[model samples]
Target: MGQSSSARHRRNLTRPSQISSSMMDGSSKGTDLVQEDGVIEGHDYISSIPDDVLSSIFNNLSTSDRKISAVVCKRWLIVEGQGRNRLVLNARQELLPIIPTIFTRFDSVTKLVLRCDRRSVSIDDESLIQISLRCQNLSRLKLRGCRELTDVGLAAFSKNTKYLKKFSTGSCLFGVKGMNAVLENCKYLEELSIKRHHGVLEPVSPDFIASDSLKTICFREIYNGHCFGPLIIGAKNLKRLKILRCMGDWDRIFQTMSTRKDNPIMEIVLERIQLTDAGLESISRYTNLETLHLVKTPECTDMGLISVAENCKKLRKLHIDGWRMNRIGNHDGLVNIANHCSNLQELVLISVNPSSESLEELATKCKTLERLALCGIETMGDIEISCIAEKCVELKKICIKGCPITDKGVEAFAWGCPNLVKIKVKKCRDVSGKVIDKLKARRMNLVVSMDSIQIEPESVVDDGGDGGDGGESEPTASSSSSNGGSGSGSVFNTRFGLLAFTFRRWSIGGGGRSV
Candidate 1:
């Protein structure tokens, strides 16, 4: 009986090959035999897919998954080589060891994204030089958060990668000198983003300003601490210019470039800059502007904002923050924006008080307004918000932080704005969970955040319940007492808190807060 069973098992294995001619006759027994082979032969299933289809599948995988997929088999390795156009080498310490080998396999890469954690990983000069030597067909290169790249590495890269078009090095440690080397060599570059480098030298000179293909330039958090003349002059044909945390004689820079009628800048972002009315007027002459962001420009007054609204008629999006308009009434600047920029779609105004009438004008005139953010405006009531909600039917997002609004305000929004999808009320004390629940029921798509209540600081109470003038009333004594009092009271008390508070009060009362 055992010999007979062994012969039956061997016959079961070779039965499909023996009856190949019978399978062509469409017999039920042959079909069942092929199905059984398919269930047992898992490798054969993947082998049926063509190389081109496998390459397309590999292109959609993540970097780690792609590395694993490449090692599945010789066929998969070839498929990975065929899909070399989709190579994104994020700089991991482990990945650094295999980069050379990976580059050797992918010799025809077109778009390469090199991402590194600036705080942890350090990309040295040798690595960049190696990359430039190996990847010749590299066109789009994005180096995000790479800190160890200096001028020598950039010079090597720019000298090698001549076909580069879209280059973005965001939050890198490259100084202006390194960037100067890159701009000088990469003449075919189109889009550039250089963020958060506190260097003192200029990046581009007069000799490197002749690129007709360049479209976007972002200088975010680049504090050169000197004049921006050379940088601005080099970006004469830039359509988008973003200057964040830069200090210089902006008025002179704007005046010098205002007369260039042949060159027109389309978008400008001046965040936390010291800009005056003259600088704003000079920038307003660019009639082709589509987007403008003046965030945290405390020195800019309502007159400057009014001038921008009146002049830049083609403006589509406007974001302004920390512009104290106590001199100009609530409706003046907003009225100008409503009357002139009728095509406005996105508006963000923080700490700027606008009346209900101005909100009505904005809602009625700017019918295309979609996203609105009014943060830190303590005076805006439910009536003004309701006016915006009722008139601006296209409004999709409303972010109100540090605003004095209650459940009544939430009710007004629920009733007036039927199309509202998102509402963020951070630091809004009066917004209750009940109101949020009501809105969630009415508008199922609505998203509400109650982060205000959870983020409040704990209030302290005095030991003397009668609120008498205790020793804790003194700023020095209060801080020293809270710090568990270093035994030498006089020096520690006077040096730490009392003197600092006194100096701060004196400086504020002496009218010394100016640019």
Candidate 2:
């Protein structure tokens, strides 16, 4: 009886190849024991895992890897479909033909990024509509470089996404119809970022009702300003507005805002926008503003800035940038702002050199100032930095660029500002790497960086031949010139390398060239 039972057990145990086929046919249970290559193994453990637990494991994988993982088994395919919440299909234009199928696979996706290459075929209305119909849970969508996307496609997509909160698209051919579609349908839309859209030339009627839920709006490299007027008027809850490299009369938008007594805007950013003192005066009506960014607006002067400071008492962050040092001026604006906005925590100045008196007053009055960024400020040196360190007790971050500052200035910051956590020094040739190293050594936890400067000079030199044959061997003139040529070549290569490295770093680290 024992021998007969053993024979039956051997007959029941199947090979690995037969196990997969039998499992698909529902002939084998997941808990069944199996024999693989004549070796007995325990019951399948992976499929026994709960869906939620397996989903968590798949969440950590890349989108491409997840697609590949789906083919492993039916269970993995199910997990890939049910678990994915974020989908980023970057440069996958080849999949444009079957976008609906792709969307069907990832039905649970909430945040979607469909970024295509400039040279590839663009996604059309049908594809977008398919996505909108399927991915109802999508909250954030970023469409980049889809040049063929028209107002029809945009409207079709926007009409379906009722829950979308944030939407950003660049290099599209959409116009007012598309904008109106989104504003009319997505009542809860909080943020909209439109960049390099060529078709936004026509005006949006002021009577058009837009969702008041918009809090942030960003326009970058757009040619027309007609659409902005309606958006500014409709976005009653707007807090942050960033306009960069956009050509148009932006003063009208501010003028419109000035008429609204209940404007809830707290943060305003005007980068490379053409506006004069009148525009600034119009913006001064918002007394509740907490953050303001004015970068590369040559038409704005000290008078315009002073108006903003006098009115916006609750201001905490301020960034003023200019194209040229001469275009910006040092005046009582800084002092007055410091006096009024005592709670100011961050200040950024570019191309505008603040006077010692003004900086001293700012350091004294704005005791809560924590982050300071000075770029291309020719007058900023040891005195200004020292004053900032001494008075701004809460200071934690300092970024100095293109300023002729030396070790003395930075050393003062290290000694005076005990709370200093990050110091980024770039294009300040006078500050050596040795001083940075010393400062880092002094404050072990402090983050210090001297851009493009080699810490140890000896590391780049060749002393192998010079050490042994020093006394008797006198160097000839030709050899010296050859060495000089080599040195010059090395210097050129080093500078080129450093410049390339700096540019690459800026492209990645710096958000944009606007400020």
Candidate 3:
């Protein structure tokens, strides 16, 4: 009986959405839907509001709720569509038949996504050209799994959509030629992100000249991404860059970037690559860097850390995942971070072995530090945690995972960091509820979480061999995540949460936040 009533309710709600284009044209822009007295034929009186008022309300609503409002009445549908500035359409071949109609209804869209499932036939060049004509005002375009798109289609669309400022595509077949088309025709393009692009590995760096207007570029899983070295070097005004799992001779490229005099990079994320101390040495040349995330890097050493500390004193957020590699930094090299980069606000060390002396130094010098996460540090015992509790007075959020700290170190929190409010503890077997309660009792406002955090599937990284330069052939698929239970692997599993947690926290540069 309830299912029947639910089906009937849906039918009644959808009846109002059957309005045709002729009816929409004939209806007064500000008038009520069914009656001039602000009463619908069978719907509520709420939508009787003026078009501007309805649009204002829709603007404040979330995208899902606005979609619901669009189905209420013809006037509401028109107002909601007008207020909708971002739209994502399924880029299947079937959608081509109604491209004109869809664009006509949502004519004001400024950010558009053409996404198709891998199993379906994607929209081709003709559809892209048609979309380009309809969405001339689009500032951001994301193409996902659109395998039918090619350089010719991209160039054609690029010629028509000069207003585009941000372009992101993934699982698409378009290569460097299509990528260059956007750079050439889209004069205002400032950001470009490409993932899994099959044909970008062949070396073409010498011919590429990126637009000076570009500010940010991100590449993910684009093997041999170093072929775009000229593009990166040519982007004179580029400020932020993120390239992850894009195997290539990035170390050499980093060396090349350091030689430029107009370098303006302020934030960068380099992950799962063949990064080495040479790249870090080159990165140290970015004197204005404020945020840096070097994840899963094994070749970097204390010299790189010292170089960055000595040069990029303006850095506010720093994160490094050493993956149990003790070579990343030690007492002398890591101490430079605290001694020179005094403005640091947030620090995250994963699978990194830092000495107690560096911890004390960091707490003493980086007084402005507010958030800290130390995970998989085998030697981070009472001394290190004590240093954090005693000196990091401004600290608010802290996460300690898979450390050997005992109840004595845990007890230090009872009187330390008056500003501390939240703490997350995981895989610490020595922590007892009695001491936890004592700390909570001492700091009445503090919240302690001892949850057995589990690893997320997407957050796991397999120990892969050192990355190599992108070859001419395309890459194959591989799964990189694993599960953990009550055993030896549990330690690594529970610590995975902190890996994602700290990465997210450090991504927020100066609290203003960066992507």
Candidate 4:
């Protein structure tokens, strides 16, 4: 009965005339006061609230939500007039017609975020020019999936927004030519992200350098079939740089950037690029680096990995694929990293064979490690895993996919690591169903996946070759007494028991078999 009345109240509130002068007064509380002819009668709703409170609420909403709320009524539209430091208009082509109206109302917007759906809306030159003219104070602009914005629109923004500090354009079709004006004009710009864009014309001019204020820049998927030396030279003050799928003259780029004295480069990310020892040596000159990610670099070698470990002393986060590369350090790069980079907290080593001693060394030295991924590692056995479980107390998430570990590893991990919350052991052959049962019994959240239903061949055979001397195996009378009712072999019973136990344990939240 109460729910029905509440629904009716909500329906009445949706009506245009439900808000009236009486409702504005403090007396009426039960019903929504309204006039007879469906007209809202109240002035205090807008005039009474403080401007600061209204602006705070407006800033909290997303770009689209703000646009919808702005057009509800004259009073709400007037609320847009309040000075807001940041304004985000994302994916509302319907709101495009109302941009001028919003601009006329709100003249004090500083940061503007424009996100459009590539399939639906096309942000043409006129729209962008209008925005540049109206929001003159816009210092930071973020455009995502805006395909229609060309060089003309970008030029307007560059020339108009003199104080622009940060700009991010993602999934756009424009290239370096469109951004030439901005890079040349926006002297105060600090951060820039140009991701997944194509058709790069040559940079403006070698003489036209990037703003010294530029600190963090990302050039992702900038496949223009040319070197990025000119672009890198422009951003002299760049501290953090991400170069993805732009593998051209990295050696020269790094060597040039290392020449900077005052504003040295710090963080570097090279994902899916072809980097070799020469490239790594060029990168090694940037000794001030803090975070480095080398993902899917097929040509990477142990010499390169060792160069990074030896040079970059302040390295904090390191992520590298271990499968493609053969050697790491003198033996493997893992030992070099453990010796040099003592401050590493987040480590992701893929398909690398880290020895038991090196694993123990990492667990002891990198005490601040919070997230670790040792996927596709065939050499690390139960002993190495146990060392991590015992020493890395702060570890929250550990992924051990494609490792050869059994119940001993799982038991050791569960017993030692108290704060572990998530574990993924996909394609592990030795982990049995009994381990899953033990995990459930301990009320632990564990995700363990097996690749095949067949029992592992290693579990059946004993250490010695003493199963049988003659052609037929011996079935002793004493063994029958211990075998219960079913006289099948102990190996068969263990396998069947594991299968049955796992079926029951599968009902728990995070355990399954993957074929």
- Index of the highest-lDDT prediction: 3
Cα lDDT for residue 22, candidate 4 = 43
- Model 1 TM-score, all chains together: 0.74
Residue-by-residue lDDT tens digits, candidate 1, 297-366: 7667778878888889899878766545453325788889999999897777766677777878998999
In candidate 1 the C-alpha lDDT for residue 370 amounts to 70
- RMSD (Å) per prediction: 13.8, 12.3, 9.9, 15.4
Model 1 alpha-carbon miss at residue 505, Å: 41
Question: TM-score for each prediction?
Answer: 0.74, 0.78, 0.82, 0.69
After superposing candidate 2, which stretches have Cα over 4 Å from the reference?
1-41, 62-69, 90-97, 325-329, 453-515
lDDT of 3 by residue, 397-424 (tens): 7888778878888789888988876676
Error of 1 at 278 (Å): 1.2
Compared with the true structure, the alpha-carbon lDDT of candidate 2 equals 0.73
What TM-score, to 2 decimals, does candidate 2 have? 0.78
Ten-residue region with minimum lDDT total, candidate 1: 462-471
Instruction: Pick the winner on lDDT between candidates 2 and 3.
Output: 3
lDDT of 1: 0.67
C-alpha lDDT of all candidate models, in order: 0.67, 0.73, 0.77, 0.66
Q: In model 1, what lDDT does residue 87 have? A: 63
Q: Which candidate number has the best TM-score?
A: 3
The worst-scoring run of ten residues by lDDT in candidate 3 lies at 463-472
Candidate 2 per-residue C-alpha lDDT over 1-515 given as tens digits, one digit per residue, 9 for 90 to 100: 55798777775777667567667888735335565345436545687889888888777786678778888999889787878877767634466567777777778888888878887877777778878888887888888887777789888888889999988878888788888898888988988888888877778867886687888888889888556678767888888787888888988878878888767888787878889988998888898888788877999988888888888888887878765635454757787787788888777777776789998988898888877777777788888888887887878767776676778888877677778766767666566666766775677667665564423232232111322111123232111122123332332122111221222222233222110
